[model samples]
Target: MNRETLVNALLILGLLAAPFAADAMGEPFYVTLATRIAILALAATGLNIALGLGGLVSFGHAAFFGIGGYAAGILATHAFNAEPLLFGLPGTNQMVSIWLAAVAAAGMAALLIGLISLRTSGVYFIMITLAFAQMIYYFAISWPAYGGEDGLSIYVRNAFPGTNTMRPMSFFLIAAGLLLAGLAFFALLRNSRFGAALQAGRQNEIRLAAVGIAPFRIRLVAFVLSAMMTGVAGALFADLNRFVSPSMLSWHMSGELIVLIILGGVGRLAGPLAGAIVYVLFEFALGGVTEHWQLFLGLVLLCVVLFARGGVVGLLAGRARHG
Candidate 1:
């Protein structure tokens, strides 16, 4: 196999082996860590579709992520209370249902946000998105139903078909499956005609316009799809934590998502995955080594930005044109 194929193969093998090894070692914490990697990676993959492919530097993606988390939390709480969701709609605790709702909510929000943001470009676009996210964050904090400033908690982990999701390994596998599916989607999109247009629009919008293609529409579509994917990750994350709050909608969450992309190498398909892996590892390792771990993380992030350039993926795969 070529280098890329060989690297991917090894990575997949390592991820597949992680759960079993963690179980054998009688250490469930690592399983949770691995799950966090997968879920965050999935979220980053969604952002990559827009930031990497469409060159849309959205700063409000956390809105979608928070929406997804709220969807999961709200549904679980209502189901636990045996209350109706809305218009007498019965609340459900199924993971699939929660994910679907999260995706829908995020997609809808993206559509609205993209319509207005796409009218502007560059700094204006970034600031607009950030403003929208802040609005959502403040709203979540003010609203009391789903725990406003306080977060909503799930007493029991939600169930999935044919699996005891409460089990660490089982849930990890579920997250892994979602991650694999997301990767497949990314590959498919990257190779498709729309992907070509989106990438082209990013590289040379004027040329694309010369060819009679509207960069605005293409980017808007990409932005919405990106939000939807991140939304799914948010749903999974809420399930993982069994809690949801305004914190998920905050600007810090948006910054963290961007950090994942930049640290991994922007635009690379596996960049987010690699970044999530390294980021979590840093958090875990540094947390153990020092009380002021965040200070070290900031230092490391600065190094990555200045020295690494393309990110971990670029370091591994050679510099790509974008990322």
Candidate 2:
């Protein structure tokens, strides 16, 4: 097999392996960290679809991410309190329901945001997206009904079919499975006709337009799809932490997701996983020593940008072959 393909295979296997090893070693904390890497990788993978494949650099993706978190938090809270949600809808503590709600909420928000923001390009696009995210962040902070700045907490981990989600191993498997699915989707999308048009529009919008394809629609769809994936990750993330807060919607969160894409290798399918693995491990390894660990991380990012433009996976796999 080719290097890129082999690297992709090993990355997936390694992600699952680490969690299993951690569980075996009685280091459940490490399993949680591995799960965090998988969730962040999934979130960044969503962003890569728009940023890497479509060249749509979104600076406000955290809006969708936060929305997903809130979806889980709200549903679980209501279920725990034995209260019905709006419109007399019953609250659910099931992961299946929470995930569906997260996807729906993020998808709707993405649609509305894309309708307006996709009209602009370049810095305007980035700023508008960032502005939307900040607006959401402020809204969450002011909405005291859900504890405002204190955030909402999930009293219990949501249930999944026949799985004990409270177990670190089980939860890690769910996150890793989703991460794998996201990667598979990325591989398929990158090879499809739609993906070709999306990439073409990124290269030359005028030519793409001349070919009777509307770049805006394709981008909008991609943005919404991307949001859905990230939303799911957010739901999983909230469950992992057992809380949802405005911080998830903050511009800093958006920036971090972008940083992950850059660190991993942008468009490469396994790049987000590689980036997440490195980023999380670095944080775990150095966070206790200094509060300014980010400074060091920034230097590493500079090296990646200057020396390894394709990202971590790119460094190991040579270069992407879009076949």
Report the number of the highest-lDDT candidate: 2
Question: Which residue pairs of candidate 1 clash?
Answer: 266-323
- Model 1: how far residue 46 lies from native, Å: 0.5
- Model 2 bad stretches (over 4 Å): none
Q: What is the TM-score (0 to 1) of candidate 1?
A: 0.97
TM-score of each: 0.97, 0.98
For all predictions, the C-alpha RMSD in Å is 1.6, 0.8
Task: Compute the lDDT of residue 103 as modeled in candidate 1.
Answer: 94
Q: How many residue pairs clash in each candidate?
A: 1, 0
Which parts of model 1 are misplaced by more than 4 Å? 321-323
Taken over the whole model, the C-alpha lDDT of each candidate is 0.89, 0.92
